[model samples]
Target: MARRSTPAKKKKTAPRGKTKTGKKPPKKPGGFKRLMLGAAMVAGAVSAIIAAASMLELDRAAHKAVNDLAKSSPAPDTSDRTDQPKQSDMDFSKGYDAPNRPGYMVERVPEGENPQNDTETIPEPRVNPAPKVAPLPSPEKGFGAGTELAWQKFATHVPDTGNAPVIAIIIDDAGIDKPRTERAAELPAPITLSFLPYATHLPEQVATARKRGHEIMLHMPMEPTSRVVDPGPHALLTSYDKVAILNEMSWMLDRFTGYVGVNNHMGSKFTADPERMAVVMQVMKARGLMFLDSRTSAKSVGYQEAQKFDVPAIERDVFLDDADDAAKISQMLDRVESVASKRGYAVAIGHPRDLTLEALNKWIPKMQAAGFVFVPATDIIRRNGVKVTG
Candidate 1:
């Protein structure tokens, strides 16, 4: 039993076409072959390093080219460059003299993203004190001189709104509050904005206003009634002789462009004087301008002088915000509406006050509902209180 041996077990064989699993052991190369392989690897590494260095050099050259180009070339001419890319400034496709304002543009941007429409935002107005271009030509009488050219340049394009009562709103003391002034210009309704000649950036501000479908006018500061009230520096005074008054007005008139006429700012004493107003109207007639009597005084002879000169003329029916307070301003706004309703057309003068602006923001649109169409000062000049009055 002890000697009895079991049959020897035989190893099983793999099938004919089957292969083993897992990784196979690496095969060794011969000496010369290995040397060749090593040399190939080394060459590949060297080539890669050279390619990387070349790419880096190319990047540097590209950057240097851009820098050189920037240094040698002048900066982009943003002087005429608008906020957006488009065709002409005055071309409008839609309703009632659509805005042609500086920041309002339809540009070809990238394939995506909204085009820059700065008309809805506050425009950062600027005026080049000494522009590189040559100055405008000297003033001549009656033709290319003052408001005649301005009528072409500054007057808002009006639609044929037949038989509609017009409301002309003039905002005075502009160019100070860039935001409110711009907001006033942004109104969809056509209105008028009068700028103070003393403001620093007259050209840019006035240009923006004119582009925004608003008529432009110069707010001519003059002597106020009260002795304590300071109209401003170089104010036209009743005491000034005709020559002095004309000179002062000329200085103010030459300050900017695109204004159809002048409106009194605080000229209580000066406007009341018939002689002073006659002097003012003489200059206005020579310049081909209309006059807007702010009517700071019932004694003002401005409208009378304008009539005498055959100059287009109108007077403010209501001062929108004599009081800066909102409630009072709202009442004044009611008065503006009442006056417009009663007279069929009205000219309302206001300052760039917060309360006034707030009131206007809400009330201006009411003109449409109130059965009055918004118009520029030029429109009122075209139609004195006679034709438009109910």
Candidate 2:
């Protein structure tokens, strides 16, 4: 066993240097120390970067919060107040007051501040105040007095002719203006002018018509189904009580004088209401006036109501001048003539238009030549044996 043991291999060694033979070579640092130093340096750099990022984020968040608050809040009042700064006066170059400017109150960034994360709010401009208005004057009393006097003068001029089959031409809605009434007076035959009370030119129109020897009547306004209709300023309605009707009637009668009868101007609704019509008839009867129904509504109870009140009444048979055209008017004239020939007499209503007047001028002479007599409305009523209530 001793002979079989093998000799161990000897280890190799390097020779020493001659210049710095006594100095030994520097030993390398341990791997753990180098790794720890490298880690410390990296951590320091990372901390600096994180701090800078955090500061930037904080500033961005502050700016955003300020913009949001401004937008959510109510706008400041700038009208009439000089104490506050105007939108034009705001300095937006610094970005802080940019949000206060007319266009930048929502997201304006301050100068030197990054706009990528900045925000601001803007407000609307104030409007001017409205101007004050003045109040209107009160209406004057007895405004239609002159109109009544003109009518009275007309009534005094009624001729005392014997009763015959009179053909009355009651021209309604007169007294609108002096020129119109004066023109109406030029008719060859006498007419009954139903003048509207309290018209713009009531006094002069009625007086002029009366001076021309025309009979007069009151063209009283009454309510209709349409709310858009203007029944003049003083309209009679079903809603009015007896006192109101009487007062209105009296005022109307006092406004115009020579009216021998009363007629509806636009009494579609009033004529349909029996109770209201009764009141109107009763007032007419008391005033010793006759009643003429314009027949604005087919369902009108005007005739029945007048009879109930013992007032002389008649309804419009034909509106002679309904058509505005000359050809249509001529056709209507022929129809009127046919009716007159057959019935012996007929009551026709026409306006004061130039067309109507021209037609009348031509047709009247023809009728006279044909032996057709022209009579007043009263004469027609009396000749027909229609008893006068008054």
Alpha-carbon lDDT, every model:
0.64, 0.58
lDDT of 1 by residue, 37-92 (tens): 99999999999999999999997985674454344323323343243222133322
- Please give each candidate's TM-score: 0.60, 0.56
Q: Assess candidate 2 and give its lDDT.
A: 0.58
* Residues 218-248, model 2: lDDT tens digits: 8887776554445554668666655556667
- The candidate scoring highest on lDDT is 1
The residue-level lDDT of candidate 2 at 187 comes to 79
Model 1 spans with C-alpha error above 4 angstroms: 1-153, 384-390
**Which RMSD values do the candidates have, in order?**
20.9, 37.7
